[model samples]
Target: MDAPDTAPGTPQAESLEVLYQSPGLPRWRLPPALAALYGSDLGFTEPCLYANFVASLDGVVALGPEYRHSGSTISGREPADRFTMGLLRACADAVVIGAGTLRASPRHHWTPQHVHPSGAADFAELRRRRGRAADPELVVVTARGALPADHPALQTGALVITTATVAAHLRSSLPASCTILAAGQGPALSMREVLDAVHNRGHRVLLTEGGPYLVGQFIAGGLLDELFLTTAPVLAGRIDAARPGLIAGQEFLPALRHPASLASVRRHASYLFLRYQFHRSITDASDILP
Candidate 1:
C-alpha cells in the first residue's frame, strides 16, 4: 500500500530518505511505518498489516546460502542488500519460514556479534519495541520433521510448526526451551493459524522473507498484505528460459475496474524499487495501491 506522504521539512520524513540513500547496510534503512510506530494520532496497531522482502531481478531470495551466489564481496553493493535483508529481521515480531528454507539458509533471530559489527546488532532492544519481553520467535513450518538439533539458532529458542504427526528426535536433543506447535497435517499449520498465534504475542507487522513456494502460497491464499520489490538495473536473462514464474500453478492477476495500482516507484541510481499493495479481497493481484 502507498504509505501516507511525509510532511515537508520534518526529521521523521528525512529519516526515511536518509535511510534509503545510505550506501551500505541494506537492513539499516527505516521502513515507512516508523513514524506511525513512534507517532500518535493513529490508534495502536501499525497503520497496515503487511509483509515484504527483496528479491533479485531474477527473483532469487537472499534468506540464506543463495546470497553468496549473488556475489557478497562486490564491495559497496552487497552490504546494502545484506543490510536490507537483515533489516526485515528486526521488523517482524516473528519471522515465518519453510523447512526447506531453514535447512538451506539456517538463521538466528539475532545476528551474533561475529556476524555483524560489535555494537550494531541489537536483538534485545528491537524486541522490546514490539512489546516482546524476550527474543523474537522463529516460526519454521515443515511437512516433515527434519530440523537439526545442533543448528546455532536453537540458543534463543524457536517454535517449530509442523504436520509430520510427531516431533523429531532433535526435539529431545535440543534445549528444554524449544516448543513444537502442531497445526494439523494438511497444509501443515495454515498461514492463518500461524499468524493468529504470533499476532496474539504482540506482533502486528509480520515480515515474510520468502523461499518462492511459501511466497506463492500466501499470494494464492490472499494472505499477503503488501509487497516491497527492489528492481536492480542488471538483468539475469530468464525471460527465454520458460522456467516457472513466481508460483508454479495457475494463479494470475485478474482484470478489474482498477486492476493494478503503482504506489511509489523510486529510483536510486540505475535501480528502481516499486511497492504494490495486493487487493486480494477482489481476488486480483493487479489491483495495486495507487
Candidate 2:
C-alpha cells in the first residue's frame, strides 16, 4: 500500500489510492479497468466469511431505527465505495444479510451490477473468469421470520435461513424463488449452523452485509474472518442507545478482546477503506452462546 493516486482522465469518476497493504494477500484475476479503478486486484481464500460496512468517523454504523438506509447517508453514495461494494459482491459466492437489513432497503438488490452499473461488464467478466454464477446468491438470516414478502431481492430469489417453526410459515408466505433452510428450533439460530448450511449449498466464499446485530453474533462466535470497513468522513451524533456501533447486542471489551491485524488500507479523498483480518478462535457457535 501507500501508493499515489491515479492520473486524471481515468474511466471511473474516482479511484482508490492504496495507502498500505500487508504482504501475501490472496488476489484473483480482475478486469483491467476494475483493477485500475481499485488500484489493485482483490480476492479471498475459499470458505471465507467476510463482512463489509460503511461507518461514520465516530464509528456509528446505523443512525437509528428511524433512519432508513443510513449507510448511504454515511458514505454520501461515493462512487469509489460503490465500486468496492460491487467488487466484493462479485467475488463472493453468496451475499448474506439479516432480515432487518432486507426490510430496511426494500428496493435494494444484493448484486455487483446493482451497486455499480458502470462496472457491470467488468464484474461479469471477473465472475466468468472465476467460474462463478452470473450473480451471487442472496441469503437472509432471520429467526423471527419477519421479512417483506414483496421485497425485490426476495422476488429475485434468496436463501431464507430461519427456525424450523418459522420455516413452515415462510414457505407459504415468501415467493417461490426464495428457498427456506430450517436451521434450528429456537428464537435465535446459531451462526455455525447457518454457515454450515451455506457451505452445503456450495457457497464457499460468503460476504455478509447483515447490519450490526447479526455481525455481532458472527464475531461473538468467532466466525468472522475478515472485515472490510469504510470510514466515511462524518460524525453521527448519538442522542440515545437507539444508534448502534459497528458491533451491537453483545459486548466483548473487558474480559474477551478480539484483536485484528490491518491487512490493507485504501483511500478516496477523506474516505478511508480499511481491511482487517481476524483469527477464528471458538470451534463452534455453541461455545459462545448458551
Candidate 3:
C-alpha cells in the first residue's frame, strides 16, 4: 500500500495493515489521508445499522462495572483502532448509544475528530463529500430515562429516546440541544422502534456504540447489519459473571445460532481489527427460543 497523501501539518501515525478484505464491499469516497490510514475506503448501505466494539482476546468487552473506559483500556488506545472508529463515525448520519454507555463514558464525544484528531480535516472533508452535517448527530437510547444531565456529551447535544414518561421528565432537565423522543411505554423499548425513530429522522446510516445489552437488543431484533470488532492482544479473564462478551442479556449458543461472515481484517501491531457482516434474518429469540 502507498503512503497516504496526507495534508500539510496532519499528524501522522502508522497506517492500518490490511491483511484481508472480502470482495464486493461497498466503497465510499474518503480523503486520501483517511483512505491511506484505513488501508482503503469505507462505506455502508443506506438505512444500515452497524455496531463497533473492542474486546479482549478472551472475548471480554467490559471489565465489569469497576473499571472506567473499558474500551480504551482494552484497546490500549491503539491509533489504528481509533482511526477505524473515527472513520466509521465520519460515515454515519447518527451515532447511537445506550444510557449505560453514556454513563460509563462520561467524557466521550462520539465524533470523528474526538476519537481520532489526526484525521480531523480529512474526516470533515469526507463528511462534506457525503453531504453530511459538520458532525454526526448523537442519539442516546434509554428505557428508564436515567442519564447524567451534566455529562459533557449530553451538554454537547444528543437525541435522547425513551418512554413517554421519561421523555417528559428528561425534556425539562437535559440541555436545550437535546431532543427527547417518546418511543414506547415499558421497562424496555423495542430495538425496532428505536431504529424506526432514528430512520424517521432521516438517518439512513446508523452507527451504534451502545453496550452489550443494547447490542443484544439489536441482535435479537435483527436490526444490526454489521459489526466492527477490534481484538486487543490481551486476556481479560472472566471472574464469575461480571465480564461480558460482545452480547449480553440474551443467549444464542445451542438453541439459536447467528453467524457472521468475515468482511475484512486489518492489523495494527498486536491489535487485530475485524469486520463482520451478519446475513441471517435473526428475529426475536423469544419467538424461536423455547
Candidate 4:
C-alpha cells in the first residue's frame, strides 16, 4: 500500500473502531420494532424466549451443586438476575430445561401462586414505561417430569414439559396439578416441539434460563437466537471433572454454523455483559427458533 493515510497525529478512532467489530455482529442497531423484541415484553406474538445466564470468566455456567447458582453476588444478581429471571417468567408462557438440569439447578418455585401475580406490583409500572406488558405464562420443561407440583415454582401453576418416556419413568403418584406435556418416543422432548407448543399458548416472548446441558442442546441444535451472557471477572476453575458447569465440552461458536454476532455489551460490578443475536440463517427459523 501507499504511505499510511492516518498517522499518530490523525484521529482515525472511528475508522479503526469499525475494524474491531465482527462481521455478523450487529453494528447498526435494529429499529425498536425489530431488535427490541427482548427487552419489550409486548412485541412478541411468539417471539423466541429470552434465556439469560451468567458465568465466570471460564465460561462455567454453573458450579458446585446449584446450577447457575453462583451466590447471586455474581453478575446475574447484585443487578437482580433473580428478578430478571422472575420478570422473564412473568412475561413467559413457559420456562424450559432438561431432565438432568432439573436434578441440577432445579427451581423450587419462587414466584407467588397467583397466576396473574398481582400485576407486577412494582415491575408493572416500569414495564408500561418500556412499551411492554407485565403479564406472561410460566412453565417448566424437564425430561423426568420430576418437579413436584407441590414445589413453590410449580405450585403457582407453571406448566411442565417432558417426554413420554420420561413421564413413564416419573413417580406414579406425581401430582395431578402438574400439567405435563409428554414428548417424543424418548424421555426428553425435542427443543423444537417445545417451542411450537409454547407458541400455541400465546407467550409470544419466551425466556429460557438454563443449565449447561440445555444451553448446549440449543447451540448444537442451532436454535439459540439471542444470547445474554454475563462474564464475571473470575474463573470457576479446571480441576473438577463432574460438576464442570454448563457447556463444559460443548461449543460456544460452532465453526460450521453461522457465528454468534455481538449485539451489545454492558458492564456490571466487575463483570462484562453482552447480548448477541445468533447471526446467520437461524434468527427466525421455526424448526430452530422462529
TM-score of each: 0.64, 0.93, 0.93, 0.66
TM-score of 2: 0.93
Candidate 3 off by > 4 Å: 1-12, 286-290
Q: In lDDT terms, how accurate is model 1?
A: 0.46
lDDT of 4 by residue, 128-183 (tens): 44445444444566755556545544545556666776666553544655566664
lDDT of 2 at 80: 84
What is candidate 1's CA lDDT for residue 215? 65
User: Which prediction has the highest TM-score against the true structure?
Assistant: 2
How many steric overlaps does candidate 3 have? 0
- With a 3 Å backbone cut-off (N, CA, C), the pairs that clash in candidate 3 are none
TM-score attained by model 1:
0.64
Q: What lDDT tens digits, residue by residue, belong to model 3 across residues 1-290?
A: 00011124444457899999999999997899989888998988777889999999988898867777878778766677777888888999999898888877777788888777777899999999989899999999988778999998899889998877778889899999898998877655777788889989999999898888888878876777999999999988875758888888888888778889999999988888899999747674751110
- What TM-score quantifies how close candidate 4 is to the native fold? 0.66
Ranking by TM-score: 2, 3, 4, 1
Q: Positional deviation of 33 in candidate 3, in angstroms? A: 0.3
lDDT of all predictions = 0.46, 0.84, 0.82, 0.48
Best by lDDT: 2
Off by over 4 Å in 2: 1-12, 282-290
* Per-residue alpha-carbon lDDT of candidate 2 for residues 44-148, written as tens digits (9 for 90 to 100): 988899999998989888877677778878877777887888888899999989988888887888888777777899999999999989999999998889899
